[model samples]
Target chain A: MPQPVIAAVGSSPVGRTDFPGRDLFSLALEEAFEGLPDPAELADAVYVGNQSEQYEHQIMHGTLLAEWAGLRNVPAERVEGCAAAGALALRHAAKDVRNGEHEGVLACGVEKMTAGGTGGATDALSAAFDRAIEQRSGVTAPSQYALLAQRYLHETDATEEDLAEIAVKNHRNAAKNPRAQFSDEIDTDTVLESPPVAPPLKLYDCAPVGDGAAVALVTTAAVADELGVPWVTVAGTGTAANNIAVAERNMTEIEGAAVAAESAYEEAGLEPEDVDVAEVHDAFTVSEALLSEAAGFAPTGYGYQSYLPPESREAGWTDVSLSPSGGLKARGHPIGATGILQAIEAYEQLTGVAGDRAVPGAETALLLNEGGVADAVTVAHVLTAGTEVAR
Target chain B: MSGEDRLDVDSPLTLPGFFSALADGDLLAGVCADCGEVLLPPRPACYGCGSRNVDVEPQPKTGEIYSYTAVHTPPPALEDDAPYTIAVVELDSGGRLTGRVDANYDAVGIGDPVELGTRALTDEERSLALEHELEWPLHVFEPV
Candidate 1:
């Protein structure tokens, strides 16, 4: 089987933006195809990851994005798993390449979350939950995650301050990232004192609703060699779905994510200890902690120490650095576009183009993107250093 | 809830049927015959062991708070209902579900006993519901 790799990647500036989804996708494509041929010249198919049709009141994202990229008559479609849609698109492209079905595929994602404002985003996102109970109970995204945070804090040695520190650390990391939404570093007090969107979860603890788009060209070694562009191997991919209802699943364990990550690790022939950096979905502060444990990077109940350095974290914790792109917390969570954004961050880190926030000598990385509340569905990808053809 | 059952709104395995039962003041759960996992608002398949041999059983109305939070910011439809307390309650029968709480955020704590109650959908909830969902009763938890 051919090894799939991400040859090129780009993302629009994250956070509340003036562009529509398609326009944001253009900006991303511009950066991704910067010194290369047009997408139509190389891409044999296109996949777009999109969360909802309610935000921009538009559908047919695959057709629209493909047309915008100047490609036509390609196998194009929109993949949806709420927030995990981007990685779903990437995963589809990777499979197409690995199976020798397509030599070059464009995997892209976009979300104009700011178009309809916060209320619109909330109503749209609620559709990700089980409508029978959780949605009927008026659970917003924050409240759903707060249900987990409340339990996590109660059951663990971690305090609310510890969760706040996760936000702070991400913001500090974002300060060094040009594409981040909130680049200014914040103190723990900022997170602790922010207005409560949900109890035990202040407003700052929640990832801001934003607009973004990202595009990645997934192809085999031949395509990367032909393009002569810096690229990284897409070593493995895994995805899993748990019960959509938060109450029906293991609220704090995020077991679905664990299963997905393990599948990726197995395929990549690696263990968690081998990963140098990761972009775990920190959609909420509690999520980073929960996913840390779930992904095998942190010991049970000690994931909250993610804000600390590797040496400072509890025993059994791996040396893997989490969310060098500042994660969804500071990098911005633009719904569908987030998974592609994560892949872009990993691409930059492994290629040594991550600038100030780069994890030095980073060779392998994990990208975990989730949809719904705490892993209703999850997509994990393992990336190892691949060819970086001379420019 | 039999594996051979053909589902309809009246079937206990379906949400409409489950809500209809809740409207009649009887909480029901699907007890997995294989793993003994209790699925709240009974379904045909068991998530614990992937068993389809689920038995529809009437569950106790009382349970304790497994976790709780207050929605200080709510969806636009329920903006007036901001700061409403909600919880994930683990019942004595081993089934867990979420519902609104009839108390303040500080008034409840984990492990606090609460009794499940049913109320006709309010205008706000009705506004958010579809034509088929209009008749589904909303579950609430009251301090016991």
Candidate 2:
């Protein structure tokens, strides 16, 4: 069986837009096929991932996006798993291609969070939590992460300064990303002085709400060679879920990320040391710290110490880069669009298309996507430039 | 002035109709007969085994703190009394419940022994008061 290769990846300019005549599905579809070499050719099928219909007020988004993208009458399906929506879509598409059901497939992810105001958006996002237990008890995302942050602080020597460093670094990286929501340069003092949304988590510690879409074109390696297209192969993908409520699990540990990374590594036949670059889910500063530990980039509770100081990056610590695309913090998190955006970033970095913030000589890149509070569900994927899989 | 002037009190001694049997000073938890897993908050179904055969049973109220956090910002109703500890208490029957910790920050830690207690409440004239409120049941954990 021939492995599927991502032939092309495209994304909308990921910043706050008026979105007057355009909806999320429309905007994403336009971006997906924007620069296709052959506009007449259509994907054999389409896979769309969206978290909530309540947020978009549009139910059947898969069909709507397919029609809007001018690929109507093709088989289209939508997959939802909280924040893991995009990864799930890719997984389905990969399966279809691997099974010879489809020659080429299109996987797109979009979220119109700004369509709903803050309160409504929050309610939609909170639907990912256990309605009977966590949500009813007023355990929102920030509150759950706040508890984790408290426990993490107690167990580790990490301080507020360490978290601020991560914010500063990502923000600096985002300044180079034209599509990032926060393009300004932020420093450690600015991050630390920001008002606390939840204890130990300042306002800058959270990823911002924005609207965007990302799409990838996946085809067989044989098709890629025939079409004369530059391609990066999907080495492996893994996903896992943990308890919805933080009280039910150990707050200091991210079991879901660990499990997902292990499966992905096993499938790719690669170890943590093999990854040259990573686009981690840093929805919150503490999340970056804990997830880094969980993904085996650093020891447990010591992820905060892994921050490459601004001076250190200038002094050549950029070899092993994390979030060169500004990440969720600076890149803006549109919920459903996050996982797909990570894929696009990985595609860009691996192909040396990341412009100014590109990682040098990047061969193996891993993208980790997380959804829900306290690291509830996590999806990880490893992408490589070479065709290691035998056709 | 009539309705607004009435004194309002929220107490841990309060037991709702669902938990009226607990007013007798016995602890209660909703247990699923099918899977034999006890659940806190007394739900109607068993999440573990996905069984709807659940019944409320009296159990011991003693437990230990599995984990805890000092909440500096309380809910709007509890803003005045800021900086309270909320904990997940693991019961003797291997069940866990989240409630307020009735100890100072330094005194409380993970795996600390705790016992459940109720807050006493008083009504007007100290005569017409019911034993407790029926809606808001407060469960506090004190260092054992």
Who wins the TM-score comparison?
1
lDDT for residue B5 in candidate 1, whole number 0-100: 75
Query: How much of the real interface does each model capture, measured as fnat?
Result: 0.92, 0.04
Per-residue CA lDDT of candidate 2, range B1-144, in tens? Answer: 257533232111222533444445656777889988876656555767888677767778898887665554333333444456667778888887666677765578877899976543222212322344423234577889
Error of 1 at A276 (Å): 0.5
Pairs clashing within candidate 2? none
Clashing pairs in 1: none
Candidate 1, residue A331: lDDT: 90
Instruction: Please compute DockQ, using alpha carbons, for every candidate against the native two-chain complex.
Output: 0.90, 0.10
lDDT of 1 by residue, A41-127 (tens): 889899999999999899999999999999988899999999999999999999999999998999999999998888999999999
Instruction: Give the 10-residue window scoring lowest on summed lDDT in candidate 2 chain A.
Output: A310-319
lDDT of 2 by residue, A223-321 (tens): 777766677878788888876666656678888888998888888899887887888888888888887777777767677754674244322123457
- Model 1 CAPRI rating: high
Q: How does candidate 1 score on lDDT?
A: 0.92
Clashes of 2: 0
Task: Name the regions of candidate 2 deviating beyond 4 angstroms.
Answer: A20-22, A37-40, A309-319, A387-391, B1-144
Candidate 2 matches the true fold with a TM-score of 0.79
